[model samples]
Target: MSAWLPIAPCTPRDCAAHEGARRAPLAAAALLLAGCALTLLGVACVPGVRLLAPSLRDRLVRGWAYAVVRAFGVRLRVTGCQVEPGRPATGELVVANHVSWLDIPLVAAVLPARMVAKSEIRHWPVFGRFAALGGTLFIERDRLRALPGAVHALAGALAAGSRVAVFPQGSTWCGRDGGGSFRPAAFQAAVDAGAAVRPLRIAYRTPERAPAGAAAFVGDDPLAASLWRVVTAAGLTAEIRVLPPIPAGGEPDRRALALAAQSAVASDSANRPAASVHH
Candidate 1:
């Protein structure tokens, strides 16, 4: 899998830290149960949600996403929402730094888009059903042969004015410190459709705002263990900073476009916040 799938050097032992505040076992279990219930509810509502108007559906999805994150007892802080005075809300590619499983709902809360997930997620229990219901595009990242088809699908969606979210890093990293680069192949879709690239940076922190490494879902970490640690981490905050959108049409090629996006996401001084939300 390392041949095609991007690999990160971070392991649970080296990357995860137990520095965050802890919650009682009972509280953690309660929070996890609440989160699970909310997810199931979201899944059940998908068919009804699909019948609603686009604008209304977007709002409902965002609200549901917010609730999911909140139910897990994670405080969300958002900065730099990508909005213009009269820009069309669709036809843009939403890209972000991947940190944990929490990132899916977190981004959806901000900008509800057709998520680009791995094929493995399609076989998971509740999340898989929800993902399929919500129109997630599953990519076989380990297989090089599937690359073109994925890109073509992404381009088709963008051409039809759909906002699609993808993590070009291919796999999850420990944190943003030293992870995989944004692969250029995905950028080709944006270039083909003349879509803009919207980049966002997501980070996990303690109540004191220190880096919450315990939240990292790095190498050799089981999903249940990561999920448990996330629920039990008291006052664990996810700070999402949205960077400026790049016009992919302006770039010479996908490589340059990818580099520009990677640079924007990695930079700390990208700019001031257009708006801030503490949810």
Candidate 2:
């Protein structure tokens, strides 16, 4: 079994606070538009608009999102991306490590995936509205009664060939050092839907500073301030690695598969070749 380790910690809270203060205007602008974006997306969900493939629309939305991130001064660097020969049909489940709240837009920039986000996100002004418009599947962490329905909805999406991205870690972490653990329940959707699991890893490295934990931005640490500090601080880049796809069936067990994927990401050398081992 391979052990996984995080590449870095969360950025310093002090730094995040400092930068966020400077980028207030930009953050406000983004937040304001966040609602308009969702409204536009909701309109696109109409029957006539639904005719337009959600994947297609998702791609456009993703592009816009990437542009937004860049505009906000964040640079994304992707590595160890294994391009499978034959692409799996839509509805495949993508499992990734949960790092920070920013993971959503970062992942969206790469793949056409709908996130399985927390229900609270549904209430977040523009973000919530757009997420719904983009067909995001919201799952309640509590209220056991809602689990079944949410699972059904996810399964239905997979059944129809839509790729859903799940953060198997369940919750965010301070970084790898902060006992980054994977929650097995997040894997249930892939198992139930018989979809392939694509394990993903994201590492955020501050150019001149260090990394922080998931809570790096709350409390007195204003959201806008933390984001700006990380964004404008020289050449900070986030590295996202997508390991090879694992078919959700047979032998190696889900735990073993999870470890395999975890190992691929935890490995330090980004330039190292990805191993293609089948059990």
Candidate 3:
């Protein structure tokens, strides 16, 4: 992989030219088609398709996501995925630090859950619609107003046996510039609902020598170019690690529990072992 890989805005002219020249239109098209197909599949699942069990939707989505990345010529590698034996049973909140847009499908591949995403995602071209159909909850970020609604909605979901995933970084950052940190708000839903919070970490390792901020959509990088670089560049890897589950511990204060869970995730990402491929 090149050293300076761009994320969403800026792209190296050389990389663009190379990708355009050697680009596998079929691969990209396949991804586009598969994305649509998966979205449809989610809808189909709602009407008794029953191919994906009630508790397995998240993993099914993950499988579809892996297929999407593979179709785009990117490899998906997962490590450190294990549910604690004494951990609260399934159907809880899964929280993690937000790294990239890729985290959605990446985590979904491991745990099935309805994502708590920003309301803006509801408007995304293809993804937003698909996420909605996949049981994602888009909420406003305003703390005071959104907190109650978030908690209520999430509690009901968990009580009804739905797994929910939230990014509590308060914003997106890949831990560079010391940019990433888990926000307490992300854990509010789980804490309020007395649900176990499973922390996960997402990292992108590029084989090319792309710049640090290259793969990020921030800065002047074009979305198309950054995406192209990721797809075309060789040795692009997306890794997801599901750390130990944090029991609610009777803590009503979501912030404290959120921090504890965050630390657990950071530790897992830093010290936990790797995951085996599940074909």
Candidate that scores best on lDDT = 1
| Per-candidate local distance difference test | 0.83, 0.58, 0.59
lDDT digits (tens) for residues 39-140 of candidate 1: 889999998999998888988998999999999988888887645322255489988877888899998888788999889999998779879989898888
Over the stretch 216-243, how does candidate 3's per-residue lDDT look in tens digits? 4444446566565555555556666767
The best-first sequence of candidates by lDDT reads 1, 3, 2
Could you tell which candidate, 2 or 3, scores higher by TM-score?
A: 3
TM-score of 3: 0.74
Kindly give the stretch of ten consecutive residues in candidate 1 with the minimal lDDT sum.
81-90
lDDT tens per residue, model 2, 159-207? 7777888766565554535235565554555666777777777766655
TM-score of 2: 0.71
Q: State every prediction's TM-score relative to the real structure.
A: 0.93, 0.71, 0.74
Report the Cα lDDT for residue 122, model 1: 99
For candidate 1, give the lDDT: 0.83
